[model samples]
Target: MRRPWGLALLSLLAGVAAIAVALGPLLASSGGVHGFAFSTIGVGAILIGLNALRRNRRAPSAGVLATAVAGIGAGAIGSVAMLGMLVTSPGGPTLLPFAPAGPVVAGSTGQWAASTTQVTLTSVAVVGVGPTKQVVVGNGGSVRLAAGYSFRSATSNPQLDVRLERRVAGGGWTATGIEATVAPNAPLTAATPAYSTTLATEAVQYRFASGTSASAPVSVVYENQHLYTGMAATIYADAAPYCPNTAVEIAHLGGREAGDYAPGALLIRISTAVGVRANLTRASQRALALHECSHERQWLNYGGSQEGYAQMKAAAAADFTVGDNGAPPIEHAADCGAMALEPNGYLGYGGFCTRAELNEGARLLNGQEY
Candidate 1:
């Protein structure tokens, strides 16, 4: 029997993941200094750890120390490399040189829509180029794309345009005629479109013709839909005004993933802001309001430090699944900070947990074990 290419790829990915998991602790200990370097180190560490652990208990060998040193050193190098990459171009900070929050630009298409994977086919419409990022889908049927996805076009008609039309479940590929032309190397602005659409959280694929140069289909992630509800309830139980009677608003910020304001609420940019609208889940809205309100409180109380911390928390909460409707995750550190601070029973991103459950979370944040 012949092995499928997908299976082979999966095996390779699994191997990589195993390596990453093993090295994660060492890399994490470095405080993510090497950006994705730790991830690579983690992979190496995992491979080493597994081999050592399986080799039967002995008084620890030079090999173990060697592996540890290698992992840490690699992690350090990765950190420096990532920092260099970040500071070397217009694309660093992801949200740095921040513009008013809007939609993220995907592929060469100047078109922006919020929902489902914003699949782009290079053959259909070529445009700008850089990272060639892709969209992330959410558990709630929302789709988000990272600003990293871009195209470069020096052609006379240097336009990056692609459309992600709705496809019938198990049907034909995305039709080619619906494609659009994207503006090249333009600063994303308020004039950007909020191309919003509803995504099916169930598994879906980006359909492009064979031999097309587009990247693979990235899934949207639906984070904490269940936990988000309970968290909102806990927050609104006390922080009512900010929690509003309705759900909070989320919008895609700019070429990069980020957040912004809306009428009486905040918008988490799911994809591009083109035709973007507030598509908040009942829980997501409440949690965001609480989260944003906390930001306001942080600004009033602690100033820059607290404000920065709050932003980090919001970013973590904003991380999406395979079909999330926001831009790629931003400010995850802030999210973790907020999670540590708000140790009540709310699962801000997912849903709710009992007071006991949340208390456990608090302990975990505080470095205590139940």
Candidate 2:
């Protein structure tokens, strides 16, 4: 009797295809190749074992029995691996049976709608305001959040309550007393009224929630105004677009340099002279901020502080000069990045950066580095 080699080969090919699919980033999410490979290999082994068992069933050979045992073992291992992967993978299928005794409940309502019903918070933005003339003179300010939500339901005119939540210091979310009701009557999409609140010293996290659904949180950092004043604040704000998360600080550097970035701390410290130079003209200030922020971007592009520092140190060592005529590669790259931000504006090291440096700076800013 001929063995079922064709079927076994097909199963093996299918396993290989599964592995390819898993490895392809566009093909799968969350679970990587290992899980898919293990599961598929186990299934293939089981199929091969079953084919071998059937082929010699009339007079079962030792080889057939061994193959069956091996197949069962592989299947067991694959099942375990698959279960672990699924359990750990976010938004993946579950093996546990979900048997509901009653209709699914959402929020406080028992109005069971089809599974198609969904409420999603789509967009969120922050608008900040300085102190008003009518208000008492102070350094404090306020910010208003505009949140938008979308809803869909199989049932007609399904309504849901959207709530704005802020993360508290206790690592839990609390409602900000901002709520809005949305239904299909309003065409299933609406923007909630702006929720205004006083600014805090630290950055705040906020999100919009509707029942069990929630939007991704946004962090509002007010450090630009709260931590900095005068020209420092202006420079920080100007540089913010280049590196939004990097913190800016004004300090006395005793004429060492215009500005310096601490990659480990993700902070940019500007010399008092830089701020003074910045106050001379808006273009100069913007150029200075852009240069410092470019350093932060460089750190980000090189991965993190450790790798960035190491690579930058190597580049600096290979360079000839740190003066305006010729600076280190890192400084040259930053100057080039500043040029990328303000192509027509005054750059401190404008004459030093080469065409390649300018292109590299632009590439880093655009996240096009391969």
Q: Pick the candidate with the highest TM-score.
A: 2
Could you tell me every candidate's TM-score relative to the true structure? 0.24, 0.38
Residue lDDT tens for model 2, 153-175: 43323346667676744488888
lDDT of 1: 0.33
lDDT of each: 0.33, 0.52
Over 4 Å off in model 2, which ranges? 1-200, 203-229, 275-279, 312-326, 349-351, 368-370
Which 10 residues in a row give candidate 1 its minimum summed lDDT?
123-132
lDDT of 1 by residue, 1-370 (tens): 1222222233344444534443343332232234344345434433444444344234445544454444434444444543443233222222211122222232433232222223223222111111222232222222222121332222112223344443334675564343432333332211111222244223344423222234334322222222334433333343344322222223344554323322211112232332235444544444443444443332222222323435544533444221123322322222322344454422334433344433433342232322
Candidate 1 TM-score over all chains jointly: 0.24
